[model samples]
Target: MLTIGTKAPLFAAESTKGRIDLQTLIGKKKLVLIFYPGDETPICTKQLCAIRDRYSDLEAADAVVIGINPADLTSHQAFSGKFGYDFPLIADEDQAIRKAYKVGKILGFLFQQRIVYVIDKQGTIVYAKKGNPPVTELLQVVNQNP
Candidate 1:
């Protein structure tokens, strides 16, 4: 996984909200990249929904929450539509972004491990951890950084 204090890898990919370019967002907004195993799975849904529940707080902090997985755009769209998620879910079907971030696979390469990264406006990753961390903790980091 990517470590804290490292420059975030840049990429452009299709998302539910249209094409997303990391370079364009780098200097403009803080970023929360939630890398999950699969779309609509129990743990993944719960993890993202927690962010959805408190999305306004993230927005108020000038942060954009993006979900990334190997799922295709169609799967991401269906999941986002069902959950009413406001943020973009990147269709990393090729797993290029995953590879760039050094996210590893589990279940014998069937699923990517769940990880969360908080990147500051300058595109430096400030927080990197595994599993589902509380949104409050994430807010503290984002609010504390800038």
Candidate 2:
């Protein structure tokens, strides 16, 4: 996987909120690209909803949340709306973005290994960890810088 401080690979892909360009989405704020293996699974749903439930806090911290999966837009929309996900769940169907970020799963993986990357305003990664850890940790990272 790409390590912290690496230049975030740029990509413009389909998202539940519509076409989302990385650069365009990161406007004036840091971004958290949360990657899950697939959509609608138990852990994935819990993780996404956890973020959704605290989305206002994320926004207040001047940070943006975006989820990535291999699912297409149709699946993404259904998943997003079904759960009222506040952030964009991006469609990384071809796995281009996941490969760019080196976030793809191994053969035995359950779900993309559940990772999160906190990218600063300049699109530089400042924090990277596994399994979405905790929003508190993320909030601390965002509160401190990026």
Candidate 3:
């Protein structure tokens, strides 16, 4: 997992809309990177939808919440459209971004460990949640600090 104050690793990933450079998406806003296990799974769905519902709040905090998963772009698009997700879902199909972010995976499974990285404007990871953090608390931090 990335630590606070260390610069976040750069990434250019496939997104439902198009290829997105991390820096570009974050721009001048705080970047909250949510790394999920996979798409359409129960917990993932709930967490994402929760975030979806709070898009405006995140935007108000001057943060853009980007979900990163190993799923392909097609699945990501369908998932986003199905749920009307306002934020971007990043397709880390090759798991490059996952590795860069230190989102370790199970040996044989395709799923990634759930983690969230809250990065400041300068790209240092200011906060990091290594496992399945309590949703309410995470949301609170994102909502309050965004």
Top candidate on lDDT is 1
Q: For residues 25-47, could you state the per-residue lDDT of candidate 3 as single tens digits?
A: 55577887899988888988998
* Clash count, predicted structure 1: 0
Top TM-score hit:
1
lDDT of 1 at 10: 98
What are the root-mean-square deviations of the candidates from the true structure over C-alphas?
A: 0.5, 1.6, 2.2
Local distance difference test, each candidate: 0.96, 0.85, 0.80
Clashing pairs in 2: 37-111, 37-112
TM-score for each model: 0.99, 0.93, 0.88
State each candidate's clash count: 0, 2, 1
Question: What stretches of model 3 exceed 4 Å from their correct place?
Answer: 25-27, 134-146
Kindly list the per-residue Cα lDDT of model 1 for residues 18-39, writing each as its tens digit.
9999999999999999999999
What is the descending TM-score order?
1, 2, 3
